[model samples]
Target: MKKLIYCVLLISNVLLFNSCTDDKPIFIADLGSEKIAFTNNFASEYLLSKDTKNNIADRFIWNASILGVNSNYEVQAAIDEAFTKPVSIGVSKQTNITVLVSQLLELVDQLGLDEDPKTTDSTGKPNNSGVVYFRVKSKIGNGGAGTQEIISTTHMINIKLIEKVPTSTTCNPLWIVGDAIKNVGWNFSKTTVCDSDVQRVKVSLQNGKFRFFTAENNWATGLNFEYYKGKGYTIDARFKSEGAGDNNFDFIGTPGIYELVVDTSKKTIVLNPSGSFWAVGDATPGGWNFTGGETAIVETSPDIWQATFKFSAGVFRFFKTQGQWDINNNYAYYKNAGYTIDTKLENDGSGDANFKFVGTPGTYTVKINAIDKTIKLN
Candidate 1:
């Protein structure tokens, strides 16, 4: 019994020794370096707006090794190098952060020598060529405590300085309009006249076409027309006799092949050789026309008219029109001799009226027929 007890005690002591030898605590020393890279270029200017007044510390300090840096690095450029030691531009205590240069800096940086170097220039300003460096040490118990020992250094780029010349008094066509006017205001073609604001100019093109005047002018039968799709076209725009006499109108489309036709017929005037007629006062060009002699009486109304003219595909504008009439009479008289008449045309159910023709030239045939056939007595 004594010999068996001795054997069991020996085995237990061996097992305890083996366990103690296999278990050991591990110690690892982390001494890794951290870097915060940046460039002093035009693109870097955004950092100034981002770090305004240096009150926001989050933008500057990226890692524990470079803590306390803010976006105020831009103001550092104006600082006098005579100051005691290198000042901190930006610092962050975060483990990892990425910094970008201002767009302006990036632009100027690309131009090799538009800016000066470290030495003061004739104006006695410090040269901005030198790059700024940063470092950060982590505090105990902080998650980034291990990175505190690392230090990062980088330099600002040197750029050449260029002289500014006074702008010329002469105006440049391209610069006069600038980028703002490229696509502003409502697109006239897509919007109705009632929806458009006053004084808005819209552009449209037709080979040769005519449109009506609005009720604001007593709904005169005289309308706006243009022609420029052929050798050249003519425009005939009639207005209230008191407004303006028939003045030679300009065409908005290609200046060569279209023409505007004004039909003073009191009855329905077919705009196309086909049987359709345009509503009096309703300007429907790209249609047809009929003639009225001195004694021939045609009715007048405040409706739109139509006429069709053969045209090749092209952009055109009914820019201007011309007519002759007495101030007291709203009816337009042919240049020779004629009396004014009225056509009683009203607005199509929609309570809106305006005299503006803006359209694009397409191959599709347009038919302009009249509505409410009553004739007006002037």
Candidate 2:
């Protein structure tokens, strides 16, 4: 009776195991009408510059799905419309990503971009600008047998290499036109000064939008360069020739006397608060616009740079580059502020240690000797 019961239980277990194994269905990954597409506003043009390498050039966002499959999205850019060998800008599991100036620079190289504005392509357009094609590539599953891939339709955007500074030192002056300035305002009647040689203008400016024009009041004629402070990057660039909306330099500075110096060649506009100099601080005319490329002195001789400016009673320092505070010459660097009005150099770092013009505040000649590391004032 015991052997009979054990045989019946074993037969039942075997029958159950066979039914479970044979009745199951084999599932396959179906990759039919699934697709990926961009779902964000794209800029009509992208401006790139070496100065703003740390800034975000553009933001790419897309929507993708593949039902039960996990999808990985990659943002890619190429000079060719048909991405023969696309360079991957970035990859993510999310739906969006920001491309940095450094990444765009890499694409610029692959596109054979020329920094020189004079260099032109076969179509007679400048090589400094070109069209860049971008797309999102989505993939599912592992890279084994059942790996699936889908590429979104390509999108093109005009890419321009911003001319941070002009290649040549040739000076091309521009006219000032904005509600901010007093005399020559945005109205076409009183728009410009009409003198091409008048590049720099000292005037009182309020909060408004301004642009540099080669021809008086007319934006379409020859070269009516507009200043852009760079949206996501540090690009001192001109506008896209469109005369509306974002085609003006939004003024953001101390509402005082300013010297509006426009470098039409470089597409840069510098509003020197007071005046520009190699060294500027609370004391100098270009008050604390420290990195605004305002050279204080002229190289009268080889190692000597001296010039005269109406300095107030405040400390000032020198900067190597405009709009950058890294490398500079401070009061402590002078070593000898002994003969100057203050007769002392602040014992602080680059931040506070500067030469202050004490006592009577008036126009004074400042002489700096780079070799001796000494400063003389008169």
Candidate 3:
């Protein structure tokens, strides 16, 4: 009876193992091949001088991969046949992308394809006259599963040659138009001159929006350029006012007195906080020590500063800040006591002599022109 019971239990265990094996499902390989390709939708030629509106440079037409549900596509162009060094012309999740003629020309020159004079056709004619190669790449996955990459075949096209138009070197007049700027006076009609050649101004402004203008406080008739906000200190901010129409640049930084450097020729605007100007020496009313005692120079004009004080028989110079005699702080000036009365402020590292009070110790007034680096005594 014991042997018969053990045999029945072994049969039951074998049947349970067979049932478990039959329920297990097999996983077939679902891998798919990713293939990408590009097509030239327009003519094989392009000219830089032509200003046509709808000149199609190239169109990237590719097949969708079965494994990739939402694959990203990037169109590439290069000078090499292997596309080892290709420039990305456009990127999108769509299977097709159309590049403009202007953009393709820019890429051709950037890839150094226009500089090659060795590529020739069957007739020995130079084919390197702006020959460009195009390709497409597809990336299949978004970090959720296995990622696969595929590259397309290279396509070639010739770009026509044209005369290069020179960019304008003459700068137009620029003005700052905003409600936050008030210290320099809201007289938008007045162009505040900061540098001799570079149009600039020192204005007290609040954290708000501002923009550059060609006309006085007018945005419709004149040229205007707009850029994004939160630009760091003294950055060479640049923008083209050609197609920007009428838009204002956002300023979301701390509010204070700022120095604006505007160049219309290069279409750039740079802003830096204006450093404090003080008169610290024997001739100043605050004495010769600048550690604690210093005479603050009031900014009468944009970059011009003025101060009036009784002078003793001694020497003095200008200080940008109160701290030390580093390059950014203190400097001497070259003074001409002749009929012209010119003062050459030492901005270079050249050592200069201090301004000497030659007259008798008495009550006198002094004016400092920080822009032209001149001084007037009366």
> lDDT scores for all predictions?
0.28, 0.63, 0.58
In order of listing, the candidates' clash counts read 88, 7, 0
Worst 10 residues of 1 by lDDT: 172-181
- Which candidate order results from sorting by TM-score in descending order? 2, 3, 1
Candidate 3, position 296, lDDT: 75
- Comparing 1 with 2 on TM-score, the higher-scoring candidate is 2
Model 1, TM vs. native: 0.22
Model 1 stretches with alpha carbons more than 4 Å out:
1-23, 33-84, 95-148, 153-378
Measured with C-alpha atoms, the lDDT of residue 372 in candidate 3 is: 63
Instruction: After the best TM-score superposition of candidate 3, give how far the Cα of residue 317 lies from its true spot, in angstroms.
Output: 1.5
Model 3: per-residue Cα lDDT over 1-378, one tens digit each: 999999999999999999998997876334355555653243446554335323444345666645544547787877668777777888888777666666766654654443334555467765435677877777664435566676777778777645433444554557766655665333464455634336777776675445666676566543334342232223343322233334555455576667777654344567777665777767667776767787776776566666667777666666665644321223332232222232322223323245556676776656666556656676
In Å, residue 50's CA in model 2 sits off its true spot by: 2.0
Q: Give me the overall lDDT of model 1.
A: 0.28
Which stretches of candidate 2 lie above 4 Å from their native place? 1-21, 24-29, 141-145, 164-378
lDDT by residue for model 1 (239-336), tens: 11122343213323342211112222221212211111222222333321222211111112112233334222221111111121111111111111
User: Against the hidden reference, what TM-scores do the models get?
Assistant: 0.22, 0.43, 0.39
